[model samples]
Target: MHWNWQQEDWPHFAYNASALRSAEDAFLKGGGIIVGILHHVDVEARQALAIELISQEAVDSSAIEGELLDRASVQSSLARQLGLSADRRKANAAEAGAAELMADLYRSYQAPLSDKLLFDWHAMLMNGRRDLADVGRYRTHADPMQIVSGPLQAPRVHFEAPPSDRVAAEMERFIEWFNATASDAARPLPAITRAGVAHLWFETIHPFEDGNGRLGRAIAEKALAQSLKAPTLTALAETIHRHRKDYYAALHRASQDNRIDDWLAWFADIVTAAQARTTARVRFLIEKTRMLDRLRDQLNPRQEKALLRMFAEGVDGFAGGLSAQNYRTITDAAPATATRDLAGLVEMGALVRSGELRYARYHLALSN
Candidate 1:
């Protein structure tokens, strides 16, 4: 069977734009709220929010490619990149590379898309990898670039990209289309719709030997940011990673035909949901800042240290709730001191305690 790229009208994607009106409106509305919140917050709060969102995108984007990265390491790497005060923990090569790409993207979202920029992104993504015939450039191997599944002997071919000789020309067209469709362009698409189309188009090309999925998601974020004229803190990768199987299935179906109404609808829903998720995350960060401000100088040094450690775990807080033992481990306090600190935190509304004595678990009051 011929793929969508092999069709007569290849790349001339047709969709009912009017059907996505509500989704587009929601995206713009959510984007305004996020920008308003960021404007009102202090510099430190904004930096923390940037670190949280970029690190999550780095981690989740890598996860979508079957590579599991340490979220903490990614966060630390992003914090350092942002010139924020961070711990001494040095991120490994993979985590550092992903963070570098994300940090660059977040800082330079307003720049126009180009071949050099995409190559640079690919270079950052393929950092520390020894395998592959090509790095930081398009695939050059003569063999067909086909995505497959199952065992080596009986592989299921999911999709095959264009031949190697055609990649350079294909990508040039893509970059031009991308730049021409920007918000300031003569003919621009809606924010969410543009992002969705950009993602699918890039992924279909699959120019890189590796890191296509991650870079595709990055392009989608770029599309959204370009339309909004600001950096998007939306959790697009995290949302896609949540329903990874469904995401792949949707792509597979869309690859069969040029009519992508179903795909656009699915992508619009994902973008809307991602916006809602980011809205909640921004509110949680606000609450966390307030809690820290409220308890400033109220708790002892150990209590302060432990509370910050828990907050480092993001909106989920410490997993399974922070136990008294966990508190001692983080603060290196004596048993009695730990108990008093925990009690003080709960008393001051910084933590909510559950269970009794040995079984007691303390959770951040601001955890979502």
Candidate 2:
């Protein structure tokens, strides 16, 4: 497919008054609910969910590192990746690693700076593990790196990275446009629309040797957060993952013709969907919190502590389910005491027992 640069007509896309207004309205409405949920969610659950959402999204966006490693491997690798001293590798290691990295990024969203800084952020994302994570710190000798889409047998190089010299200049122009357009209250485009624009512009620039897609999405996230100016509760990454094909197709269409209307519309729809999904999740969390609150009222301090630790640390001190050993570690109880605590939790409907006595794992009833 042939792609052309929209040099002269670039600002026209940015200055689309009607689209901007529509996006703005949608952003504010969606953002309000997201912010509300962010504030009310239990910190541990929220953090875990956020990590899961971001990591899954990163993996879905073609993080080969995630693809190569299973969940347990990913977790152990990520601990190694981040230089943390954790030996507990579980079934979903890659996801755990991605989640940890994503959590770090989410934390950074609390104090957002410039979109241009995305280069450094992207670099940091892939710094430790070069195998799966394509840390593109230096320029490559290869020119016009080919990006293919569609079927493998007849895959199409839909987009090409610019020559090395032009890449930096083009990226700067895109960043300038992004910062200026984002801050312009007079124009006042919606956060969702801004997200679409950021995604498109970043992909259009295609600065690095690899991982541009993930970085572009990350940049979109920053734009989304800036638009809301609140802690992000919605898993926009999940929406993107659900509509992966459409997401790529929209970028393909935009790059092919340099017309962003369709892309913006699709992005707006995804934002709306993500917000709706997050709202449901948030409501479930609230209900779970209320249930836990009631359960805590009836239990002694030890039982309450056990429950809180389980929820906070997750299904047995892991992302998924917990083991009997986890109970011992979490509660500092003897085998018999841990068994009693687990039985109590099961009785209270907070944890569901799985497997036989010797190999039982505990799962949070509220997580689903």
Candidate 3:
């Protein structure tokens, strides 16, 4: 069976832009809202929002590749990289590398794509790895790069990239197309359309031997950032991770043909959803700051520690809200102390308590 790269049309993708009209409009609208809200927030809140979104993207993108990174470590690394106050905890190589790659993307979104840039990204992603023969470069092996599953003797080939010998030439053409279709290009494609096609095209090429999924997502993000003329901070990878099965299915179906109307529509929904989530995050950060300002110096050390821990859970908050036991665990406070601190928080409007007595759960008063 021929992969999309083997088709006669090859890299020339075809899609109906009209079908994505609503989604495209919604994404742009959401972006505007995010930008406006961010503008009103103070510098500290803005920084916190960026660190949270970027950390989520790094961790989620790696998770899509079956790599479970420590979120706290990634966040700490990003906070340090962005010159914010950071935790004393050290980041491991993988966590540090992901954070570095994400920070670089945020800083260099406006730059044109190039072989050197992609190579540098690959190298950053592969840091501390001793197994790969190729790092910071395209695969040089002669074997066919196939994504497969099931038993080794009876495997199902979901997709196969072009042979290693063709990678250099293929990547050259891909880079040219990417740069040529920039938002400022004479005839640029629509924002979400370009991002969707770029992701599919890059994944079809599967340029690197590893980290292709993560890098492909990054490339898509770059396309969006270029269109917006700023870092997107859209939590795209997190959204995709949440719908990983559908994401893979969409890619598999689109990879078999040049017609990607379905993929574009699906991807547009994903982007718009991610943007909505991001907008919520921006608002959440704003509310968090306001809440802290309102309650500044009102709490004891245990309450302060517990509240900060809950906020670290971000827009999702605690799974079932923060229980008394959970608060005690976070602040190392005794049961009686945890109960008093929680009740005080509720009384102070810092937390909203629900249920009754032993069944009570405390959630942040901020809009989730």
Report backbone clashes per prediction: 0, 14, 0
Top lDDT prediction, candidate number: 3
Ranking by lDDT: 3, 1, 2
Give the CA lDDT, 0 to 100, for residue 184 in model 2: 42
Q: In candidate 1, what are the lDDT values of residues 97-138, reduced to their tens digit?
A: 999999889989989888889989988888888998788899
After aligning candidate 3 to the native by TM-score, how far in Å is the CA of 203 from where it should be?
0.5
Error of 1 at 297 (Å): 2.6
RMSD (CA, angstroms), candidate 1: 2.5
TM-score of 1: 0.90
Candidates in order, TM-scores: namely 0.90, 0.67, 0.94
Evaluated against the true structure, the overall lDDT of model 2 is 0.64
Q: List pairs with backbone clashes in candidate 3.
A: none
**Lowest summed lDDT window (length 10), candidate 2:** 63-72
Which digits, one per residue and each the tens of the lDDT, describe model 3 over residues 297-368? Answer: 798888888888888787888999888889878888888888888999999999999999889999998755
| Candidate 2 stretches greater than 4 Å from native | 6-16, 19-23, 38-49, 62-101, 110-116, 128-138, 149-155, 183-188, 295-368
